[model samples]
Structures are given as structure tokens and as C-alpha cells.
Target: MTQQELQQLVEQISLEYFKRPFRHRVVINHRFKTTGGRYHLADHHLEFNPAFLTAELRTDLIGIVKHELTHYHLHLLHRGYRHQDRDFKVLLQQVGGSRFALDVGNRRPQAKKFHYICTNCGQQYHRVKRIDTRRYRCGVCSGILKITTKM
Candidate 1:
């Protein structure tokens, strides 16, 4: 969806769910990497991740909008607006807002990769988790293995 559509959606959700009018602006934030949306305290503006604008992610987008709106409305009312607050949790659950953003694809960071080599057969192996050098041996010749590098 476009930025204009996102703004309209936020306005509609605020009125429908929070029973309040959204006077601040809402924009699609292209730089958001891990978060679904953000509610700025200084400017009272709402920012949504542009990646969740697809048709398949429509429900997720609405959930994110509700989550941000929860923050927006709570903060404006001088109530507990933080995630750890009881009012925030109660209102979020009441509005059916999602706590965590959906990781649609392989967007999360990869684990550390370790490279191992054998002394006898010179066989190389790459693994995501670290392996014990004393317990683990090379598969080819059962030779002693040592970590070569970590990436």
C-alpha cells in the first residue's frame, strides 16, 4: 500500500478501536528493519514498516497499526503507554494487537558460522554452532579437528 493509504488506515483504526480521533500524521517508514511500527513521543507521529504493505500481510498490518495506536492513545491520555505497563498490556489485548512483529521471510540475522578443518585428512566443515574439538572428529578419517575461522 502507498503512504497515503497507510495514513488513512491509521486514522480509521484509531477512531474504530480507540474511540478517539488521530490528529497526528502517519507515514510509511522504509528504514524500519526489525520493528513493525513506531509511535514517536516527541512528534506524536506514527510510522509503519513498508514491507508489511502486501495483500497477504493485510491482517499483520492491521495488528501492527493497532499496536502503534495503543501507544499513541495511551501516551496522549497520560496513562501507562510503555510495553511493561499494565494499562498498555490490557489495552493492547483488548484491541487484539500483536506483541511481536511477524517475520515473514528470512529477514532475521543469521547465526554465527564456524569453519573447522581436520589435521589428518585436511577435510573442511562449516557449522552454525560451535563444536567441541575434543569430542568431535573429522567425518572422513576420524582425525582431530581444529577451528580455522569464524564468520
Candidate 2:
């Protein structure tokens, strides 16, 4: 949907769900990579991921809109608007907003792990960051450590 259509939908949802009129702008942010939407506390504007704008993901779009709107309304009303707040939780459930942002492959890519083994003792050690095999030795046997593999 176009940005204008999304704005109308957001305004409509605000009125229907929270009984409040949304006066701020809604933006379809193509730059959004990890989040379904974002609610700007400074401007009271809402930004949504453009990836969820398809017909197949309309429900997800609505849920994201509602989730941001929940933050919008609660913050404007000076109620607890944070995720950890009781008021935010209650209002979000009352409005049927999604509790979490829609996942958009936000999982962090795992860093390569370094696997090491002792030459004499066979004790293994796994670490995320690379370690110096020359300086570090096996903890159990104090034997020379060598690179086993990487994952």
C-alpha cells in the first residue's frame, strides 16, 4: 500500500482501538531491517517496515501498526508507555496489539568460533574470539594447544 493509505489505516485503527485520534505522520521506512515498526517518542510519528506491506502480510502490518499505536497513545496520555510498564501491557492487550515486533530475519549471524585442543591431553576449548595458540596452553594439562577447527 501507499504511504497515504497506510496513514489512513493507522488513523482508523487508532480511533477504532484506542478511541483516540492519531495526529502524527506514519512513514513506510524501507531502511528498516530488523524491526516491524518503530514509534518515535520525540515526534510521536510511527515508522513501519515496507517489507510487510504486501497483501499476504496485511494482518502482520495491522498488528505492527497497532503495536506502534499502543506506544503512541500511552506516551501521549502520560501513562507508562514502556514495554515493561503495566499500563503499556494492559492497554496493548486491550487494543489487541502484537506483544512483539514481527520477526524479519533479525537474528544475528553467529560469529565464527575458534576450536582448540591440547596436543598432549586432548582437552578441548571453544571460544568466540580467536586466541593465541602459541601463548595459551591447555588448562588441564598445561600442554601445548593447537587449532582443531573453526565453526
Candidate 3:
């Protein structure tokens, strides 16, 4: 969809879901890599990833829009707008917005590190703690496992 179309959709969703008008601009931001959308705290503008306009990502696009709208509306109303806040969570759930921004890439938790590889199948694994390669075999190929890296 075009930028104009995105703006209209945001406005429509804002009124429909939040019962408030989205007075600020909504723009398609190509620079946004991992995040689906972002709400600017200073300007109140919403920036959405253009990749989300594709047919396969339409649902994600809507969710991102709703998520950003939650921030916009709550911040405008001087309520709890942060993700951890109760009001934001309740409004987000009510609007059926995504609980967290969609990570386009594999966004494993930061605490996770130990990387394992299957010797037979060449399959990779990520873990939070080191696993015993001697005892464990590849679940798919039943081959000896090896530690590839630690991150």
C-alpha cells in the first residue's frame, strides 16, 4: 500500500479501536529493520515498516498499527503508555494488538548463547546454557552433537 493508504488505515483504526483520532502523521519507514512499527514520543508520529504491506504480512501490519496506536492514544491522554504499564497492556489486548513488536529476523532472547550443531544433519541449535554434547545426539539424525559457537 502507498503511504497515503497507510495514513488512512491508521486513522481509521485509531478511531475504530481506540475511539480517538490519530491526529499525527503515519509514515512508512524503510529504515526500520527488526521492529514492525514505532511511535515517536516527541512528535507523536508513527513509523511502520513498509515490508509489512505485503499480502503475507497484512495481519502483522494491522497488529503493528494497533500497537503503535496504543502508544499514541495513551501518551496523548497522559496515561500509562509504556509497554510494561497496565493501561497499555489492557488497551493493546482489547484492540487485539501484538503484545510485542514483530521481530522480522530470529530475535532470540539476549541471555541465550550456546550454539550447537548436529554432526549428521548439520542442523543448528541455540541454547541458554551449555548442553553435554557427549550424551545428547541430534534429534533429527541421531548423530553426535558438537558445539559450534558461544554467543
Candidate 4:
């Protein structure tokens, strides 16, 4: 969906659910990861990840909108707006918003990948950091571990 459509949807959801207008801006942010949407406290703006715009993710998109809207409305009303607060939890549950944004397809870039193999069981291990084989043994059969290559 376009930015304009997102803005309209935010406004519509705000009015329909909160019975209040969304006077702030809503934009599509490509940099968002882990979270489908975010509510900016300083500017009272809403941001949504563009990855959830596909037709297959329409349900997720609405849930994300509701989740962020809960934050926005609660903050605007000077209520408990943080995720840990009771007001936030109650409203989120009432609105059926997603508790956690489902990881769509975004992945954090790994600096380096390490491949490890066990001598006995041949069990493989993939890690982002190098490990000393002597210090750590394979959990399968207490076998000696060796670093194979960078994957």
C-alpha cells in the first residue's frame, strides 16, 4: 500500500476503534525490523513496515495497525502507554492487537558465520562467532569438535 493509503487506514482505525482522530502522520518505513509498526512518542507519528503490505499479510497489517494505534491513543490520552503498563495491555487485548509482531521475512545481516562439526556424531553447528573447540565439546556424544569453515 502507498503512504497515502496507510495514512488513511491509520485515520480510519483511530476513528473506528479509539473514537478519536489520528491527527498525526503515518508513514511507511522500510528500515523497520522485528516490529511491524511503531508509534513515535515525540511526534505522535506512526510508522509501519512495508514488508507487511503484501496481500498475504493483510491480517498482520491490520493487527500491526491496531497495536501501534493502541500506543498512539494511550500516549495521547496521557495514560499508561508503554507495553508493560496495564492500560496498554488491557486496550491491546480488547482491540485484539498482536502481542508480538510476527517475523515476516526480514533478517539481520550476520557479520560472519562459523561452521563446526563433531568428530563422533558428525553433528553440525552454525554460529555467528568463533568458538574454541578444546573449550567446548559436542553435546551429542561428548566428542571433540572442530571448526570446518566459514559459511
State which candidate has the highest lDDT. 1
TM-score, cand. 1: 0.76
52-91: candidate 3 lDDT, tens digit per residue: 8888888888998999999999999999999999999999
lDDT of 1 at 95: 96
Backbone clash total, candidate 2: 0
CA displacement after TM-score superposition, residue 111 of candidate 1 (Å) = 7.9
Displacement of residue 4 (Cα, Å) in model 1 is 1.1
lDDT of each: 0.92, 0.88, 0.88, 0.89
Per-model TM-score, in order, reads: 0.76, 0.76, 0.69, 0.86
TM-score of model number 3: 0.69
- Which parts of model 4 have CA positions greater than 4 angstroms off? 108-112
So what's the TM-score on candidate 4?
Answer: 0.86
Task: Compose the digit string of candidate 4's lDDT tens values, residues 1-151.
Answer: 8999889988998899888898999888889877799889889998889999888998899899999999998998899999999999999998888888878869878765898999999999888999988899999999999889976
Clashes counted in candidate 1 amount to: 0
> Per-residue error at 114 for model 2, in Å?
4.7
Find the 10 residues in a row with the least total lDDT in model 4. Answer: 104-113
For model 1, residues 1-151, the per-residue Cα lDDT tens digits are 8888888988999899999999989888777887899999999999988889999999999999999999999999999999999999999999999999998663666675999999999999988899999999989999999999988
RMSD per candidate (Å) reads 4.8, 4.0, 6.5, 2.2
